[model samples]
Target: MAVSCVRADPRLVEFNDIKIGHVYKKTVTLFQFTAASPAMVVVPGLLIPEKQEEVRDCLLIHVEDTETIKIPLLEFPKVCSLLVDSVLDFGCIAANNQVISKHHPITNKGTAPGAFQVQYSRDPLVTVSPCVESLQLAPPSG
Candidate 1:
């Protein structure tokens, strides 16, 4: 004997394909629905339209509970590269050290150019050149 899977009730599960680099949202209004054993809705891997085989961390879904759970699928592209460190630190400088400075770069590892703003605390001891400002990064092609 072979076990045949049945289609989910249309009234229960509903989903639509989303586009990359865009946002998709749905509002589900339920009336007096009881879920004895709430089931977790897990979305495995979201397909990338451009490169179907390539898998990237782009979509995220959050389900609160069983009955009143609101499933909103968020889709976003790799607009900004991943920054391992947000704060750049300069090691303690010697009292006699003439010049104490550090060069930190905000790299854009994403497919598109990443926009960033630099901000730092006001400290008389430390000097930050190129005051906190907005800047854009060219997309890397290597």
Candidate 2:
């Protein structure tokens, strides 16, 4: 007797090719349904026509120079669940001594007031990276 081995056809992977830079313009609804301990079902997911669903941890967004991206929230409950990761961008610090020095322009004797401004600033645009991390429920930490 010989042991038999079979693998699913590789061509099946091409069913849907969702990639970076693909923007989902439609609203996606997520829900959970439970079955008794008598059973459990894990749905890998489905392929549909309108949009491809992706589960993400970190999110990326792209917008044209003129348009604004908006996500709507109806109430506090929604906000409580949303997780945000914040990164500090370039900002000005008072430690820098250089500042607008001169108050008067005509005297031209002492350092001119408000002549130089001491601060760091930049146009901070956040590049969204696909977040592979998802939140999980676990026992409470003591």
Candidate 3:
């Protein structure tokens, strides 16, 4: 038996301008051409369980079979641009066991919100404040 997509393209599913840390969904409808013989359409392991359920509910098939079709899902995230100083330098430090501090500024130049992360340095003496892994900055206009 031959199967084909009735409404949408079966080869690819594309999503555009998806925000980070957000969920988006799309459905593709498929039709089985021949009804004489039974056929099964399988969606492979690329998607999570929740997404699999969504696809299964939309598919028109009779029984579970080994025939599988791999569909590529493309997602484009919103872009965010950030500007920062090229270098941060501490001029000099005395051996008085004192904690000297400096300020570093990060500016978001893009319209979307930007997420920044400061990785830990190899030197144990060097540390970062607001020790979280990621921080989000709003757009300049906001």
For residue 57, what is the lDDT in candidate 2?
A: 23
Candidate 3: tens digits of C-alpha lDDT, residues 1-142: 4664332346576555555445665555444445453333344323223221112222333323645445566655445667768887767877488888888777765545657777877889878875543335544473
Candidate 3 residue 66 Cα shift, in angstroms, is 51
Give the clashing pairs for model 1: none
Instruction: Assess the local accuracy of residue 27 in candidate 2 as a C-alpha lDDT between 0 and 100.
Output: 31
lDDT of 2 by residue, 1-142 (tens): 4332222112122222343344223232222222311222222223333332333221122223433223231111111122233443335445354532222211112211212222333423322222223333322448
Model 1, backbone clash pairs (residues 3+ apart or across chains), number = 0
TM-scores, all candidates, are: 0.38, 0.16, 0.38
RMSD after CA superposition, every candidate:
11.8, 23.3, 9.7
- lDDT score for candidate 2 against the true structure: 0.27
Error of 2 at 57 (Å): 16
- For 8-115, candidate 1 gives per-residue lDDT tens digits of 112232223334544333333333323343433343433344521223232323233422333333333445464536667777768685876778875656544445
Q: Cα lDDT for residue 49, model 3?
A: 30
